[model samples]
Structures are given as structure tokens and as C-alpha cells.
Target chain A: MREDHHDQPHAPDHPMTEFEWRVDAVQALLIEKGVITADEVRRAVEEMDARTPAQGARVVARAWVDPAFKARLLADAKATIAEIGITVGFDATIVAVENTEKVHHAVVCTLCSCYPRGLLGYPPDWYKSLNYRSRAVVEPRSVLSEFGLELRSDVEVRVLDSTADMRYLVIPVRPAGTEGMSEEELADLVTRDSMIGVAQARTPALR
Target chain B: MTRVHDRGGWPGSGPIDKSEHDLSWWEKRTDAIASLLMSPEKRVMRVDELRRAIEDMEPARYEQSRYYAKWLHAIETIMAEKGVLTREEIDRKVRELSARR
Candidate 1:
């Protein structure tokens, strides 16, 4: 159901940026020569769109309720996540680190904006911004405080740097007094920020 | 070259713009093309390689362009380097596409 831009002429009055023109030309040529089809491009768009925080919440939810799944998530995240039928575009490894009362894990890609895009959708604007890349690892506690998440002074913060080959996912601690909650109920506490380790999972009252 | 696109610990930061805005059609297309270039299923190129290509951009252009613009630069550069699409052909196609509009 995508619009066909093949025949549309740009109104001379409205100029496109250089990159926009380049993409148009490159895509058109690629499609014409059969290197890649518009369908493939459309599928890529849909696949990226399909990746959302809900998927991450689902994974976090299961991990919270099932110790076995949580163990597998920490030991071999890609394999276990795939077992649950989730596929991210990149072929790199994703490692899940859990937070405990004694320690917290915060993820950052200092090199570039490496992220678990398959699970969290596009990294938020803040995630990719120069501000986040610079501050996340250098002063994570302060960063979290800005996100309204002030970790206890004694909580050890482990900043995980993601390389091109490996991404990191932070599994936040399960909130207290929720033993009777179902996986779906537990999943509701999981937010993108919590999974990224900037914030804690939502409490029952917040929902 | 070392800094490349690495913004880690570079400088002070202003407030983050938290408002979410929808991407334009071209930006979405650029995203698709960029991701498809590194699709695990299709395997056209490594994301590191694309990063390298992007890093090779003129320093000013690298810093001045928007993220999607950088993606376009990387994609076009890598495609040309891989012989998937020649630079001239892309230029010609751009002219054709623009003329259509």
C-alpha cells in the first residue's frame, strides 16, 4: 500500500535535499536493474516498524516471571530471543545483563548509536543524540537522575559499551510485592527506559 | 578519522528534544535502504563497513548533515564501491528522477 513515487515529478518550487534526491535516484536505479525491489524496501520498512517497545516488554516480562528464561536471556540472548520468534535486522550478538540490588547495568554505544533495534524499535532521539552518547557512560548515575531515576548511592553502576558486533540489553530488577502478578501484568511494568537501564521498572501504583 | 562518527564524551549537551515527529517519506525510504544494506537475511554489507564509508565523508559534511543524510551518503558510497551501482549511473538517475518531478 506504499505510494508509488516512480512517476511523480517534484514541484520545481519545492526542492528536495541532496540526500533525498540521491536516495530517490539510487532506489529507482536499483529497482529498475533488479538489484532490489520496491517490495524489498517496503518489507524493510514494515520489519523495522514491527519492532517496538512492546516486544522488549514481552521479553522483559517473561524474564521477570521465569527464572529459567531469565537465565537463558543472560547466557545466550540472541538464541533465546529467536526461540521466542523475534528477529532483529543486524546479525550482531545481543547480551542481556541483569540488575540486582547491589548493582545496576547501563547500556551505551560510545562508538556509534548501536542498539537492540529489533527489540526497542529505533533508538530514541535522545539515545542517538550527542548528549546521551557523551554522558551515558561517563556519569550514568547523573544521567539516570536526569531521567528521574536516582539509583541508591550504594548501587554499583556497570556501564556496558556496545560494539558493532554486540549489543547490550539491561534487565531491570522485578519490582517488589508483585509475586502474584501474571506475566502480562509483570510485562506492563517494563518500559523502554527500564530496559535500557536509565530508569527502573514501573511500580504497580504507576500503572 | 579516529573520532569518525563517535560522539562519545565530545562536549557539553543541551536539553534533549523529547517530542516525537514522524519521518518524511524520503527519510523512511533512506532508513529502509540503509537497513536493507545490512539485512541479516540478505547480507549486502556489514554495518561497520557502512560506518567506515560514512566516516570517510568530508569532516564538515559528516558533522553538518542530518542522520538520514549520513545514511544516504554511506549507502551511495558503499553501493558504488561494491559495484552494485555506479556513481555515474546514480547521478544520471538522479537527474532523470528530478526531471520527472
Candidate 2:
């Protein structure tokens, strides 16, 4: 009889350790083949880590200054993002959701981390973790609390499930004060977690 | 001498010659295969399930890669083919993919 192991998926479930080993072996083999240099791979990981969507930053900036653009972003994110020179397209579509003080919104790919990457950036480890994925849909309030965001029951907690055709990024309500801030300054106000609706954009603390 | 400049590493970093990296040809093929398999698919999977899918595809030569890699690749390829990723975007994603460990 053939070895059943060949036909079966590995047992013991969620073998992350084994998984890491396979990655190591694959990397080692790649190194042996000269397909990718160690430096290239290292740079790649760092690049991935450092890459935040400046395009996304611009989008938030526009939303802060241009009412028409904000209207367009709310109407259709893909087009509005493109209008601002941030070209967003792909198997994954992008949609911008809004959050007001009275009503807060959050996004979760209860299925996967189906984020608006073109307008966002690298997903945080927490976004891709099982803890966030599983709990967000079932208990939005508790999860938001852990992330340090709490909403009153009167404030609806809308959750959007990112799918193949459409993904979401949250456009938070601009913070109070600082009406005269520059575009770059406003962009600084937009954080990755905020765009994903996990947290709110915080203005600098008062003196 | 005909000038050819390297553009692999991020800005302010030195150039990256795809050649200097010491991945094996077989390993390169594996990486390519991994890259191809790792592109994003139309499927929506839970994080745990996504992890399992990556684990399952790990040894398939062309069928499996880490979950995020394959997922990103598929999305890249599909979008590019559809004119979604665009030429510049494709180049960027390729750089991201190559740089990504």
C-alpha cells in the first residue's frame, strides 16, 4: 500500500513550526540555486514591511480637503482613488466606508484579510491573525474594545466582509480642531489601522 | 561600456543584481512556482483555513506556496491580465514579491 502520508494533509492541525521549516528549506534551496540572493530576500521582507500606501495617504488627504472628492470616495472609491493619482484595480476591488462619531464602522475579512491594499498597505500581523478574523464578526464590540475602540450601542458597528470583487478601506471622520492643517499633516492623521476601521485617527495630544 | 544600473534594493540602499543572489536553479523554479501558486485567488478563506491551504500547497512544486505569497501573486497576475495591476504596478508587485522573504 502507498504511504498514506503522501495522500493526506498533515495532521495535528495548524503546523506553523513545520510550516516555517518548509519555508526555510524553500529559501535554502532558492539560495543554492542562485535564484534569489539572501540580501534580495532580506530587502524584500523589509520592503514589504516598510511599504505603506502613500497613495492611501493621498486619498485621506484629499478626503480631508476636497468635499467633492470625499463625496466621490463615498460614492465609489475606485474611481476617486484613481482621480487622485492612486490607481487601484485588480481581482480585489476597493470601496471606502465612512465612520461618524454617532456611528462607527470596522472591516474584517471574516473569511480572510481581504483589504484594500492599493489604498492601504501591508496588513498588520493582527489583521491576519485568527484571533481577529474569528472574533470580529461574531462579537464586534468586544474585539473593538481590545483594539481600544469602543462604540455606544446607539452607534451602529457596521462590519463589511471583504470578498473577491470588492474590498474595503475605512475613511474615518476627520478629527476635531486643526482646520488649517496641510495635506501632508492631514495624511499623517490617517493610520493603517484607522483605514481598516480598527482605530481612529488621533490628532496630537493637547499640551 | 554599455551602462546597466541595478534597481533591486529600496532607495538609499545599494543596487541588487538578480544574478548575485545564490538561489539554486531548482530552488528558483520552486520560487517561481511558489510565486505563481501564491497569487491571490477568488476564494475567501479563514485565516486558519488560509494557513492550512498554504501548508497543503507547500510541496506541490507549482501548486503551493505560503498563503500570502500565492494569494498576492494570483491577484497580481489576474489583475495584470485584466489591466488592473498595470505595467508599473506589476513591476512594483514583482519587486515586492522578490524582496518578500
Model 1 DockQ (Cα-based)? 0.63
* DockQ by candidate, in order: 0.63, 0.03
Per-residue lDDT of candidate 2, residues A1-207 (tens digit): 111201124345643343333344444433444544455555444333343656676788788899899989889888778886665534356777788877778887654466665456456656655456666776777778877777778888887766455778788878888598888888887777778887788774531
Worst 10 residues of 2 chain B by lDDT: B1-10
How many angstroms is residue A155 displaced in model 1 relative to the true structure, after the best TM-score fit? 0.5
Candidate 2, which CAPRI tier? incorrect
CA lDDT for candidate 1: 0.80
Interface RMSD of each: 2.2, 18.6
Question: Considering only chain B, what TM-score does candidate 2 achieve?
Answer: 0.28
lDDT of each: 0.80, 0.56
lDDT of 1 at B84: 90
Q: What is candidate 2's lDDT per residue for B15-58, written digit by digit as tens? A: 11112223323233333333323335422223334333443333
